[model samples]
Target chain A: MTNANPHRLFRGGAAPAALPARGGIGLKPEHYQYILDTRPAIGFFEVHAENYMVAGGPFHHYLERIRADTPLSIHGVGLSIGGDGPLDEAHLDRLAVLLARYRPESFSEHLAWSSHGGAFFNDLLPAPYNAGTLARVCAHIDRVQERLGRSMLLENPATYVEFEASTMAETDFISEVVGRTGCGLLLDVNNLYVSCINHHRDARAYLRALPLAAVGEIHLAGHAREVDAAGAPMLIDSHDAPVAREVWDLYAYAISLTGPQPTLIERDNDIPEFPVLAAEARQAEIVMARHAKLEAAA
Target chain B: MSAAFARALLQPDAPCPAGLKTWNGSDPAKRFAVYRNNVVVSLVDALADSFPVVQALVGEEFFRALAAEFARANPPRSPVLAWYGDGFADFVENFPPAAGLPYLADVARLEWLRVEAWHAADAKPLPLAEMAARLADEAALPALRLALHPSLRLLRSAHPVVSLWAAHQAEDVSAALGATDFADAEAALVVRDGLDVDILRIEPGAAEFVESLLRGAALGEAAQTAAPFDLPATLGLLLRSGTIIEATPSGRIS
Candidate 1:
């Protein structure tokens, strides 16, 4: 991994404020005009960095205006940080250019891989969690953070299957990667619940194993339920429907551990009217608020 | 594992990658199918976004099947799905099922250009006042050169690509309208007027003259080469559409 151009990506101006400790929502093209026309009071707006990787368009046209007032989270879905091969330097360069243009407050990528053998899978694919793989993942994160000249939050992946070659637990692997690379954790409560249910592990135990102190941001999204072969329960991290009840409970529990962190409600598919999603974001704020009251009383 | 996993993702028939595990000891194939579906469905969705007219022309199911085949064979080399389906027009032209609609390939080409135009670099267009003032000197018209908007793109097709695309934008596209004789050879200009992308049909001769000007030809040389062409009409169209970024006179571009 090489830091081809080790420089700050900011274009100049006062730095944007950090993601506020409140509720935000994923920015979608369908809601761009509506978001601008009726300015919604949300904490921050997160976008898949790949979607804005292009030179220019309405995505930039609206985002430039929206970002002027709102905090932004540039989540990279295509960086393939957990890739077997080296990070895509060209892709990284594009990410750099985009960040330079927007100067987003918070940047993040997944703990999973998406591209391999020069072909981008577009979905974050899983990998075996082992010492050998750990080193590679850490190296990739080091390059990403160093190349961008900023710390990034690495989100936990929502995987359907585990690998036989994995020598360490997922939590241990993630803990080591964060310990080694100095990157922050973006704990996706929905993913935590989905993976735990799929693998028959306790979600609470899994959450407790994580290094909660380094969590910079949290994600809460919807998941679809389906049984795999042999009628075993399986969950797909589909961001279509609203957040499930159990995940919200887990989110409340998560905030109890990490206190009030910036949480984003991601509705990638079947995206509804901005108000519908905004209501969900407000739901997250309620949960955070509930937990905050309990902590303040304590 | 990634190498084999990626290969299996596109080739659905292939066996699941070695060493994949699900906690319950059930077949990992079903679990693996999740990843396969994500990769294939998401890529197809991206193409559907980039080439909506192509999808609308062929109907939803057929388009998804066609786009799925195209996706597997031509999965995006780049992660930016905005630029996916680069070779789709070529692929559709050769596809056996699409042999019934020869114009589709051209329509897809036009649609691909629209995708490019939608995302092309932003540039300020020459104001109508500025363009008029530059062309004020009728004597300097021939030596005048035009710089087009960054998002300006031209597509020429034997089929009426513009009509096919415009018909789809309508709320209700009648079958008669769909089968109408819009087979006349056509050329199109896709440009962004203030943030909205506008697609205008143009005559082939005008298209050629603009194409020549795009190559840095002076107005006189370009118009002369595109003989029997309407120079004033084409220039008016370009100016009215806000396509001209700058109008430089002879030796001024240097």
Candidate 2:
């Protein structure tokens, strides 16, 4: 492998304190005006960096205006962390420019490879969890950290299938990545529910296996249910609907384990009215508040 | 595992495993098939979103087939699916099925410009008062090299492209809408105002005027480029459209 030699040096700066360990909603176009007027009491906002990765325009203006009032998190979807290929230097440079401009409180990306052999699949795709792939992913993370000059939270992917070549569990893969690269984790609770249900694993058990100490953020989103040929329904992490009851329960369990990390409510499609999403964000706030109160009481 | 499972689950030609991998009475291939379809479909949808008028003119089925073909050839290069169709205009130009709709490729080019403009970097529009005051000093004025907004995009085609695009919108009643001939070439200004992409047709010389500034020409040089046509009206049009966002001082203007 081209990336077998790991240079353990990371020169990024410290994260800003502006990103509160509270709940936020993904800032979609539908809710822009409502967010401006209401200024919902959430922690911070997260946006797809690619959505704002342009030279100039209205999206940039709106984001600049929004960033003035709220701390922002630039969640990237294109880094292709688990690919067998070399790191995309141009994409990272574009990302670095965005990071410098936005001064986002935190940055994150998924741990799945969306591109292979130069064809980028927009969806987060799975990767084998063997030693070779792990080293490759760690090297990529190190390069990303060095390029952006900041540590990023790597989100676990919601995968439907696994390769037979996998030598370690998903949690072990994530933990090993963190252990080797010192990168943080953005544990998407809905993904745990989706992947667990799809792969026939227990969601709670999967959460328990996670390196909770390395968890820096959490994501909660809606998922769709589809029945395959055998009349067995599988959960799809669609992010279009409201967070499922079980996923919320899993989030509560995650808060108990990870101690109330910054959480986000992500709805990319079939987005509802602003108040509805704020109400969802408030659900996370309630969880964080409840957990904080419990800790204070103890 | 069959070759079907290997191609469907893993990348093409990857080694096939010899057993059915199931944990909860579900075939892994059955599940993997959904994701593969979703990945391809979502990327195709992204291209469609970036080129709606092209899709509209071509119709959904044709566009979907075209998109699927394009997807196979130029799958997205970035995770940001929004930027996936940057090269689509060129692809449409070379596409066999779309060869009949010669203007269709230009329309796709215009739509892609709209996306580019809409997502371009945000910069503060120069305050009207400051610009007006700056214009008062001729020495300061000509020396000023205007900064076009990131969303400002200029496109030129040998076809009546603007009316073609406008016909797709609800309000325009222009007769020569979608069926304009390639002989009726047109130039256009695609700029983002606030959050909306505003596309306007420019007369023969007007596009040249703005293209000068966009090409990094200073005010005087840009005006010279627009001189073959009337320069003042073209400059006024650009100003009104909010095309120029800022200006760098050329010490010589002072």
Candidate 3:
């Protein structure tokens, strides 16, 4: 028999895994085998919740094993939280089932919308920062938290264009939603740098305006550079390459305010080997440790 | 804004929505292209991931153009992209560019079935010994019903889809494709053998038998549906592959 006591795995005394205040990486299918074989000492692993919204497959098989050993974060990419339409209850129900199964240490969704009028764009499109949009985003978060029975982190977006109809700044908008919804901020440093640079705003002032004390996690990813039509440099939050030097610097500054938090290296496209991404995750650890030491000395 | 934004995201040539603006005076048209590029690129990428064999059948460049056209016409309605291209087979049949490869649509269907099989629910198969005991009761055979694995799916086609799919596994796809003829029809059975999915080329009339089983037909009625079926051979394959999850007899008060 494969199991002399299969029941031993579910004794129910093992404390549920928590998101460690260290570095992590996005769990990709290509790295599943490598992650299992090497058992790299990654602090945590985050996966796109939409990817595992399946009945059964190798994804669940490996996740069941790896999740047993390490902390996990479920980052949702398709909730359409900023949409003016009502929340997709069926999707929320699925999220409830998944959260019950995994019980991840952290759950997070974006401040962007992906679907509208029965058509899903499959990309995190931006929404304006206004009273109406803010109230709607808060309501969506409330629904998600109520449905899943847990407070979730909300990530700021990396947007290229602003809305002419906007009445509030992006940072003020996020702060209002965080205050009204009582949800934690994900604080994607890459997004901060990307948006600040794209909008020609001061990155430090932008970070200061954010509700830094409410940050639960941080995201550090790479971006692609391009030229806008008016001959200004535009940066797209393309998680294809290594975490940018500027983004890493911004991460250090943000952590200095929020203290060490669970940071993730978001590499979705042009994914390298597991060890390569792990090494990048280690870089985040080094940055946190360096800042932490300075804080202690201060 | 979403109505205009969602509409514009799918239509590349559509003018940027009225309210969009860049931080600088630079044209929002250029910046809006970023969202346009993301929506179109990501959807095409999802279709490409789900249909790699189809992409291989057609060259990469051709596949991208073909996928982009499909993406624009029929975007994914749901967020879970595992079943994204469910209607690709229908689209391909009417696609004027793929007229030469009439069997392409069936191959696409076969591929989509494989995707479904991969994500289907997991279940425990009935032990072979238990199945043998149940098979021995001839009188109860008429009333016995078997529950197939949740992942089990069938695809029937005039083209040798099983051979075509298996040919992709070979080092020389052209050589493998050359060996199979399209005149013969084939039925493919997809089931989760374990954690992995297995696609088998079921024997003649066996698809009808499997279809009956899938439809909850009784043992004797399902057996009669497939003419001249080798019960031992077919049952051996199904039982060994862990496709039959449960078998219960009817008319039993006990």
Q: Of 1 and 2, which scores higher on lDDT?
A: 1
Candidate 2, which segments miss by more than 4 Å at Cα?
Answer: A1-18, A292-298, B1-20, B24-26, B121-152, B171-184, B193-196, B209-230, B244-254
Highest lDDT: which candidate? 1
Regions of model 1 farther than 4 Å from truth: A1-17, B175-179, B252-254
lDDT digits (tens) for residues A1-298 of candidate 3: 1212232222221112257889999999899888889899999999999989999978898898999989999999989999989999989998888889998998999999999988788888899999899879977887887788777889999989999989999998887777666678898999989998899999999999988877888899999999899788899999999999888888888888878888999999999988889999999999889998998899
Q: How close is candidate 2 to the true structure, as a TM-score?
A: 0.84
- Candidate 3 lDDT, B120-154, residue by residue in tens: 88889999999999999889888888889989999
- Candidate 2 lDDT, B64-100, residue by residue in tens: 9888878867777666666788888898999898888
| Interface C-alpha RMSD after superposing true interface residues, each candidate, one decimal | 0.9, 3.5, 0.9
Q: Locate the minimum summed-lDDT window of 10 residues in model 1 chain A.
A: A8-17
The complex in candidate 1 yields a DockQ of: 0.81
TM-score for candidate 3 (chain B): 0.93
Model 1 agreement with the true structure over B116-199: per-residue lDDT tens digits: 888988888788888889899999999998888888899988888888888888777775356657658878999987778899
Candidate 1 TM-score, C-alpha based: 0.96
Ranking, TM-score, top scorer first: 1, 3, 2
